[model samples]
Target: MALKPKDIALRAASALVLAPAAVLAIWAGGFWFTGLIVLGGIMLALEWARMSEPQDWRAVGMAVAAGVIAPVIAAHIGQMSLAFVLLVFGAAIAGLVSNRRGGEGLDGAYGVLYLGWPCILLVWMRDLNADQGLYWTVLVFAVAWAADILAYLVGSAVGGPKLWPRFSPNKTWSGFIGGLLAGMIAGGVMAAWLDMGALTAFWGAVLGLLAALATMGGDLWESALKRRFGVKDAGNLIPGHGGLLDRVDGLMFAVIVVAIGRLIVLMIGGNA
Candidate 1:
């Protein structure tokens, strides 16, 4: 029996609600968040390698190192500016050297950028002020969820212009607009609740929308990879979603952009 859309939606929404609370709770304890994020980074690394051609172990090692180090640096680094420069340099060098042949080079390049680095920003966001950081963590997650759900719902009903006909046939431009609007609303509400500034609203709305758009991009990006690799789904990890990569692709892009945005803001004293 094929599950009804409503049923699938209900389960997804439930999971979204419960999962982050669990994560936030776990993260509050000493080293729990760090440990969990590292574990996720490793798992995501392994999954990405399996998805790519000729599974590069060096890439896997890079992911492992990133998983362990980036979060720790973000959590404890005294000078975030210098530390971030070094982290980016390390990731670039690792991506440059992770693989020798095959299309896996391109895959390896984006995979580290996609999988390993942005997570550092998320960790920094999580540790911004413990109390404040928790909300930031939850906000990013919630914003992504809101955009995805809204896009799906509106996309189904309206079914207007396709966002990208080549990559994702099912995605409609209507869904894109819906996601942007939904993200804006979600970000606004979170900003008000958190007492964040107008600039937070700016990044939140812009980044939130970009996150939603990139979420679709991430979906299609993996879809293209799997199709090229002659596989169905990234892996059998998630129930409905293909794999952790499939689930996180959008958030991955979103966080990276948001992290860069944050870095820029911090550099220019925009946070104040």
Candidate 2:
């Protein structure tokens, strides 16, 4: 269904509060930003555990610990590789413990991997280099936000054929195109503003396009999960957005992709 007037108002109100707080935390990078990332991940873990296995303390604790610990360790020690190992170990531990709690290892492990690594990796991206880290981090946020906002607006306005009626009935092709275009533009503009050069700007636009696709994929994946589990919204944490996961589902996916891209760049000894 199209967004009602109340939905729009609530969304706007939530964004007004959240956007500024996020921007400020990001601008004050360090513990401030990492703290927020960890907190968000913990919240996601909690929601995931609750949604998947409500009242399962072992599963919930394991997920939360993994999500919170990964980013903190990565930020302090500057070891993305080690952080990754820890994340894997955490997932394994959660999985093992979950089985004892009458759940398949799959749910707990999946929840940790889903929420933990992304949180760590995004912070790692933001701390890559003192000068470039901020730009890249901001770029990810801007592109993701642009894509989400444009897609919703365009989809509501144009009312075209559904992109994937089974997964997300409200999504449309027009919205996808509009969001992709807007996200790419935002990426390119952010790159240029950061004086990243023309070549880098071009690649930024490409990254934005990929990120937009990832965003849609993430949203659809979450929706599919919700459908499979027979839940309406993740949780009513945000005013308009259903939960913390609902708000950053796209960013979680985009940052993982972006972090992987950054890792590849570093491995190749090319900074982009």
Candidate 3:
């Protein structure tokens, strides 16, 4: 269905407010960035809990909150290995708790990995290089945001065949293509402008395309999860955006891919 003017306005307004705050947090780094992420993680956990197991949402929320937060804190303190180990441990704990509470144990565990890993990776990525970290972090945000906005706009305007009606009925092939192009352009421009280490504009665009692909996959995954749980939106946290999870689903997946890619390049002695 076409979005009404009011819905579009609401989305734009929310983005206007939230995007600036997020960017400011990224620029601030350290405690500011970590705090923003922790707050977001908590909100995402609550949404996931309510969506997956409304009956015992509070219990599940607490489990997920603990699961995501500990790893984030560890990452913030420069303990990458410990952060990862804590992530696994937290997931296991969440699973056990959910199972004991008569909820989907596997889903609960998956949620932790899904939400927590990205948070850790994001923190790690921002701390990769004091000088370059800001640029890299901003690049990820820009690409994801560009792709998301363009996809929604183009998809609605050029409404055509569905991309995957099974999971997301409103998604269209046109939107996917639009998002991909936007991601590539955004990545290329950011890289060229910021001069991210040895990464060239061409390579940046390629990474952008990869991130965009991952973003779409992430979106589909969340959609499938919501469908499985029979919820329309994750939660009514944001007016038109649904929940924190709904807003950052793509970013969560893209950040993991980008972080891993950066690490691999660093290890191989490349300056990407």
Q: Which of the numbered candidates is closest to the native, going by highest lDDT?
A: 3
What would the C-alpha RMSD of candidate 2 be, to one decimal place?
A: 2.1
Which candidate comes out best when scored by TM-score?
3
- Which digits, one per residue and each the tens of the lDDT, describe model 3 over residues 80-105? 89999999999999999899999989
Q: Pairing residues by index, what is the TM-score of model 1?
A: 0.75
Rank order by lDDT, top first? 3, 2, 1
Give all candidates' CA lDDT scores: 0.63, 0.78, 0.88
Give lDDT for model 2: 0.78
lDDT of 1 by residue, 61-155 (tens): 55535643663465545456654665565556545555453334555656555665656666676666655566666667767777777777788
**Candidate 1 residue pairs in clash (backbone atoms < 3 Å):** 161-173, 215-250
TM-score-based ranking: 3, 2, 1
